[model samples]
Target: MTATGSATLHIDAPRQRVRAVLLDALSLPSWNPAFVSLAGPAVVALGTAYRITVRPGLKGTLAYEAMDLDMVRMAWQVPGFAETGDWRLVASGDRTLVHHDFTHAGPIAAVLRQAYEGVAELRLGRLAQVLHS
Candidate 1:
């Protein structure tokens, strides 16, 4: 079975600034500790493929390819499990609303749901700090 989750955070930064951080693959690890490494082009674009590794030690090398991107949204494909994720940013006054949506199949589903339920708030706090920094 596939389990899914969504998380939203409000950052003091502007939407464009938050969106920039979300779109930058190189900066992913700084905010999201689950990411071990993202090997891809220095500049990420739609259709760009990346070799991704995750924490809690997931087995096997996970492959991801950018699916689509817009000014405030980006989606990617996890080809290994046929899963996908999306991030979106919306402007609210001077703040930005950041949202993340994820899906996972099989055992990974339980892991993801557990992670979100356990430390999602803490993770969002870290994400806000990263955006502020």
Candidate 2:
């Protein structure tokens, strides 16, 4: 992995419920503060193209076009930016364990990794809360 980081959060819900929340592409802008909007098909299957606008502080929006899906695991790539290594969903008793691994690509990877790590933590926390609620 190029720029790797992982965070695990225990959600007070079943694995299916947590997965459902994560797979809801349209609801991302509503739940995640960093995401401005998402444009594409509602269902995210393999090879589905999506355009995401990310607000990295006040430096304007960074647009990324990528293909993503969950084949019992999450995988995505933003060409010159980075690729999400693997997003694994593990079942732990009544709770769910969410694991995300990402690898940065190209020159500005290090900086992007740092920025993504911060945003990822926040997003994951929100996901856990949404499932628990």
Candidate 3:
């Protein structure tokens, strides 16, 4: 079984700014608490593996699954989960439209639908704060 979700938000920041924060390993934990820490290159590159520690003492290696520089799109593999996530950025003046899509596969996916949506919304909302802070 698989469950998927998409969340989009217009952030009052340049596309480059939003893109930098979203793709940076060190910057993720500021907005998303699920990521406790990451040990790897600050600039994510294809084929690079980042050792990540999350809340509840879970740890795993994360990698860049796919990236498209020209299209301003990228995806990362989540550790210890049958899940995949991607982000697309579109710039308009000083604002950036951020689209985050997620796909999870597992027997518990149906049960996780509500929680996944809530978390995605929270993550997107917090990205703005991360920019200002």
**Which candidate gets the maximum lDDT versus the true structure?**
3
Q: TM-score for all predictions?
A: 0.73, 0.70, 0.82
Where is the poorest 10-residue window by lDDT in model 2?
57-66
Instruction: Summarize candidate 1's per-residue lDDT along 1-133 as a digit string, tens digits.
Output: 6666677888898877766676677777777777777777776666666676666544333333442333333333342343456656678889977676666665555555565553445555776898777
For residues 1-133, write the lDDT of model 2, one tens digit per residue.
2676667667787777777776776786778675666667777665555676655422222222332332233343343454554446778778777765555665556556666665556667888877766
Q: Candidate 3, which segments miss by more than 4 Å at Cα?
A: 69-80, 107-111
lDDT tens string, model 3, 56-96? Answer: 56676667766663133333334435556677778889998
Q: How close is candidate 2 to the true structure, as a TM-score?
A: 0.70
Runs of candidate 1 with Cα error greater than 4 angstroms are: 56-83, 110-112, 118-123
What lDDT does candidate 2 reach at residue 33?
76
Each candidate: what lDDT? Answer: 0.61, 0.59, 0.70
Q: Which candidate is the best by TM-score?
A: 3
Residue 91 Cα positional deviation in candidate 1, in Å, after optimal superposition: 0.8
Positional deviation of 25 in candidate 3, in angstroms?
A: 0.8
Clashing residue pair totals per candidate (backbone < 3 A): 0, 0, 0
